[model samples]
Target: MKLTKRLHSCVQLEKDGRVLVIDPGAFSEPDAGLGADALLVTHEHPDHFDEGRLRAALDANPAAALWTLRSVAERLAPAYPGRVHTVGHGDAFTAAGFDVQVHGELHAVIHPDIPRITNVGYLVEGSLFHPGDALTVPGVPVETLMVPVHAPWNKVSEVIDYLREVGPRRAIDIHDVYLADIARPIYDTALGNLGRTDHGRLAAGEATEV
Candidate 1:
């Protein structure tokens, strides 16, 4: 499969004749469409889910389905009909020929929050793991991992710990905040010599094979 990074946290994973988009957030680049088959939203947070973008994407690709946590499903299912699937922690489902396992606690930690709105990490076809803002590892075999490198609540140490646990054959960094100006150097120095590390910045419009 081929993976391409869009602005902010959006990623397009393509294989065969389909594309799967993950977290097409508000700040994503407009013309960088990948003609998605399904969209995966890990949470309803602004940076992880954007209503406007989702609408645009759906308009662009009328056949695209949306696989997301219950919190997101509740909001969109009413309008989107069969296009939305509501998943929760421990749920397992398939889309676009890949097996998907969802797990993780809500990182935002809102009080009395919708229990089903918890954070989610997807184990895709037992090959790739996309832990959308859920910094912890899910203890599954991951050939490639799309990792979030920067957030107001996360740190470098946490990211290192996660990498050690997942032990993916290759990795792509994501969810970075602008102005930190530290991810590139840190990522280069930390994973540069590792046999498994991709050792490249996952900037918008860039594509890589996995």
Candidate 2:
């Protein structure tokens, strides 16, 4: 499968001509199009999700379906009929021609005062793991790890630690803040042996193959 980062938290995964788009929201390009056969969302936050964008994508590609958590259903079910499938942590479902496993928890750090909202990540084909907004790593090893590099709560050390735990053959940093380009040199220097995307800083068009 080919995995590439799109706008913000969005990622495009292609395998055998099937495309699965994940988290096409949060600090993303308004015009970016994720040619997805299925859309996988982790949460409902603006950065991780945008109902309008999902709706627009669905409108543009009627064949695409949405695989999301129950929290999303409560909010989006009224608008999206016959297109939403709810899955929870530990659940596995097939989409985009691969056997996908759903795991991880919610983004609790967003607001220190309140409890965390429900969230989850995806393990695609048992080789690629997209943690969405969750900070937790998968129990099983993965070939490639797609993680958020820059966020309000994530630090460089935290990102590095997560990478070490996952121990993937490669790592791609996505969902990074647009202004944190200064960390590139630092991150590259620190992650000397581990893989990092060589695309121009903040540009989401480039991809590295494993």
TM-scores for the candidates: 0.86, 0.88
Pairs of residues clashing in candidate 1: none
* lDDT by residue for model 1 (38-130), tens: 888888888778877777777788787889987788888887889999887788988776578887766643345444347787777678788
- Give the backbone clash total of model 1: 0
Looking at candidate 2, the ten consecutive residues that score lowest on lDDT are 193-202
Badly placed stretches (over 4 Å) of model 2 are 193-202
Query: Per-residue lDDT of 1-210 in model 2, one digit per residue for the tens?
Result: 776667777878778898888888857766443567888898878887887778787788877788998887677667778788998889999886878999887773866877788889899899988888777677997887776777776776777777777777777677775535666777666654443322222358665443
Residue 71's C-alpha lDDT in candidate 2?
Answer: 81
How displaced is residue 115 in candidate 2, in Å? Answer: 2.4
